[model samples]
Target: MKSNNTAKSFDYTGLKRVISLGLSQSKGLFIGVIFIAVFSACFSVYRPYLTGDVIDNYILNKDLVGLKLEIFKLIILLIFEGILAFFTVYLANVVAQRVIKELRVRLYNHLIKFKLGYFDRTPNGVLVTRSVSDVETIAEVFNDGILVLLGDALKIIFIVAMMYYMNWVLATIVIVILPLMMIITRYFQKALKDVYQEERTLVSKLNTFIQERLTGMNIIQVFNRQQAEYSKFSSINNDLKKNYLKTVLYFSLLFPVVDIVSALATGSLIWFGGLRTAAAGDVTVGNLIAFTQFITMLTAPMRAIAERFNSIQRGLVGADRVFDILDANETLPNNGKKKLEKVKGKIDFENVEFSYVPNNKVLKGISFSSQPGETIAIVGATGAGKSTIINLLSRFYDIDSGSIKIDGIDIYDMDLVNLRHHVAVVLQDVFLFNTTIFDNIILGDKSITLEQVQEAAKVIGIHDFISSLPNGYYSEVSERGSTLSVGQRQLISFLRAYIYNPEILVLDEATSSIDSNSEELIQLATTKLTEGRTSIVIAHRLATIQNADQIIVMDNGMIVEKGTHESLLAKNGYYANLYEVQFSKMNS
Candidate 1:
């Protein structure tokens, strides 16, 4: 996503930053590429002059021996030019690959440290495009942008100088066409710059749309929205097509105009040089031929300059996008110096208030406490701020006001990593990676061994069920554990949380989606998982938390009642009514 301050024209700052980073990677390679490009440009300009000398000074004088020697020298220059050209392209790409690799890695590392709100607000596809596609575009700055432009610029300079030295009148004729060609190029360059910006924007939209549609294909199919979704995709795709056509239209207009001017210049050179080539005239057969070659060489780079300018513009546009991510201040502030080596599990929320959006508070002046070894269950209807409490506890979002303390220190004052390390949350929607069951449980933590994982699963009473699978703990799971039943995935999540051995455990409606048989196993697992840990449980099913040391009933972001199950039942208040509603359903 582009910010309001995004540059609409050529971004010089971004270009400079990209160049600085590239040089930092390998200054030797960059400097070597430039040196080779200069030499290559000089060779191209001199080759035509050598060809003219062979015609006038050697071949025309009937000196076959001198002609062969000049021809041999020409061949050597061509061989060296070919060798330099190969190295120039090869080294430029090597530099590009290395630079983008560093940029991509840095961007990814920055993304991982960003607060959850950043991902919540920005689409995953946009970030993916920035990290992968946009970074690739920056490579054009090296392969075809900067160094190529330098070589072309140098070719123009050398060609013009040589033309004037040979014949000032002919050089002036070619120079007259140049300003007009440049004016035309400038017009197309501006038009194409705007089009390229639009093109990248449309591509991001296309990528974001496809990513979301594929992820939600099930919902689209279930609701019979295939035709409607297709229509939406077509609209986005059509916009991209139109954007590409605009780019084509500009180039289509640009080239013909440039060719016309180049042909006129070529025609003028021959007309003047032919008249001058008469018997007492100063221009010889060789000078006329060399001047003709000069016209061709001069216009070639001019034409290429127009194209390369756009390529450079496109890369600059991409660099702006990539740098946007790098410059963003979206990462969590980890300024606390206190390390949490251990915690007593005592939790407190002192008049805490928070909102995902300003003036739309989700948790309002809420306060609560749990002892070192106790279970605190919270029950509420949807949107009653049940899960918001858990999010605040984990410091996923900073509080609007007031404070939350763990053991006696304010959570804000604790090291962010250490604070999160001691808290384990098993969400209702369990997300598992596409790996073996053992890997998912350990989550790449080598400190937790397979034997330790097996032992933890046994304690949670899911060991036998896992052992029944063909690969046992080594069984492969599909993305998000889609191959497993909801109950099975949830069971694994509990085992994952348990293995971490957190000081505070949270199960946010963990058992709501389980079947009747799996519910018993989950209930038993919950007991074992929360045995000595200070636990917070959020449940829609009132019966699940009957044994909680304290049950807090909430409404509209505020707690309405708090007490033990038996005590709340005696009050016949919010908790009693909630319990009664579910109790009646169980009987019916």
Candidate 2:
């Protein structure tokens, strides 16, 4: 069953926020929709009056011509009301589409600006749910929920007015049952609201759980943990199912109660009308018929209000969740006025210090420089902050206390877009979009031509493989490049990084996942690619970096040694000890 458990919480503040922000985006359309609603309501109430008038003044008097005229009036009014209804639906939808568009864009803009730390700490599945499903839920509110409720309320007001004007006694009788229905609605609403909020939270958890499991399916299967995973998934799925069933149960109980009230209301109208007709007979037959119709209309709105209220409440919950994302203040502050059109690769890290968590520094007073056209390799034990250095230099995360500069200017003062443009990163685990190979290589940068990409791929030795594909460069890839071999995907990463032609290239274990045959191919391409550009390599294979101009070895978040490979080996220090241990294990 489809779930209605995605409401975060019951907060009118979110609805108010949406109205405040959404109005400015499509105010004119909203105003037009309201006007159409008002016109339709006013025009519809006239028909009941006309129905009674046709009977009392024409049919009762046996004036056939007059009755025909009254009938014509009703037909004309119906046409006018139909046109107004069309306008209401069309205008409201346009306004809803506009609001949804602007709202999604705003949320996405905020997501892109958020600090990397937020992403590191937050689950990918939660973010994806916020961006995709939650945003879509908000759109339903605009399209069908609140706007429909507003129109319904107006129609009910007009209906009540007509009923009272026709006969106050009958109006009073119908109005009595409404209070009872409303009380029941309120009670059910409270129960459902909490359930809705819990359901939404569970959806995110389930998404995160499924996403992680699918991502690590290989590990799970290798470890033979399928039964364990199945049990865990069953528990979560059952929880979601229970929440939905509760919602179903509440609704099931609600509508039947509404139907019972509706039946009682109709029964009372007939009994009262007949009693008066049999006695003093102040109420005419025409009035009796009209009162019955008016009572039915009034009860319809009473029944409908409950459903509309639920829709509105659900919308409010969605709005609350979306607002939470928009209100985040954890975005990286990149407000530099400096803009560099071009940079000559010269990177310096002075007294750099950082921590993913406070009171635990990852890089401790580190200092280093990469001169232009130099290949600098970083070797370190795990947790030595080798990857942390690459992350800081790329401005993916800021340092705690230090100055990182490019071309003699602090990167903190440079435009974030421009600063990142000069840096390229190729990770050991490559990620590929589900798109054509050409599109993947170009990465939406229209300035780079196809010829340029193919040429770069050729130079990097991936062109032949791409050409062998059914669609060549235009071949469609799957999510994360699952369709391609590990070596093939890694090679594509090199091509993608190379095509950008960044001044500073950082390869963080880029060749670690490749087999020996593929490793040899990358070894040949690495030299040609790193030439005439400053490069930073992080690798477990010492052979790849033996010819590097400089080698920095780190231990426990501190750089303990730096020199040429032979020089470091000559020192027989920590680097030499690590190399011997690793190579000896390989030989064994």
TM-score of each: 0.97, 0.94
Backbone collisions counted per model: 0, 1
Among all windows of 10 consecutive residues in model 2, the one with the lowest summed lDDT is 1-10
Instruction: Tell how far residue 269 is off in model 2, in angstroms.
Output: 3.1
Candidate 2, residues 1-588, lDDT tens digits: the string is: 122334433456677777666588888777777777788888877778788788888999999988888888989999998898788777767777787788789989999988889998899888777777777667656666666667777877888888788888878887788679778878877887787677777888899999999999999999999999999999999999999898889889988888888888888888887788789686777777787677667666666777766666666666667778787787887877798877778889899999999999999999988889889999988899999998998888989998999889998998888888899998888999999988888889999998998888788776777899999999999989999888788888888888988899999998777876577668766765787899999988887788999999998899999999999999999989988998898899
| lDDT tens digits by residue: candidate 1, 325-404 | 89899988988778888898999989988899999998888998989989999998899999999998998888999999
Which stretches in model 1 have alpha-carbon errors above 4 Å? 3-8
What is candidate 2's local distance difference test score? Answer: 0.82
Candidate 1 structure, TM-score to reference? 0.97
Best by lDDT: 1
| Candidate 1 global Cα RMSD | 1.6
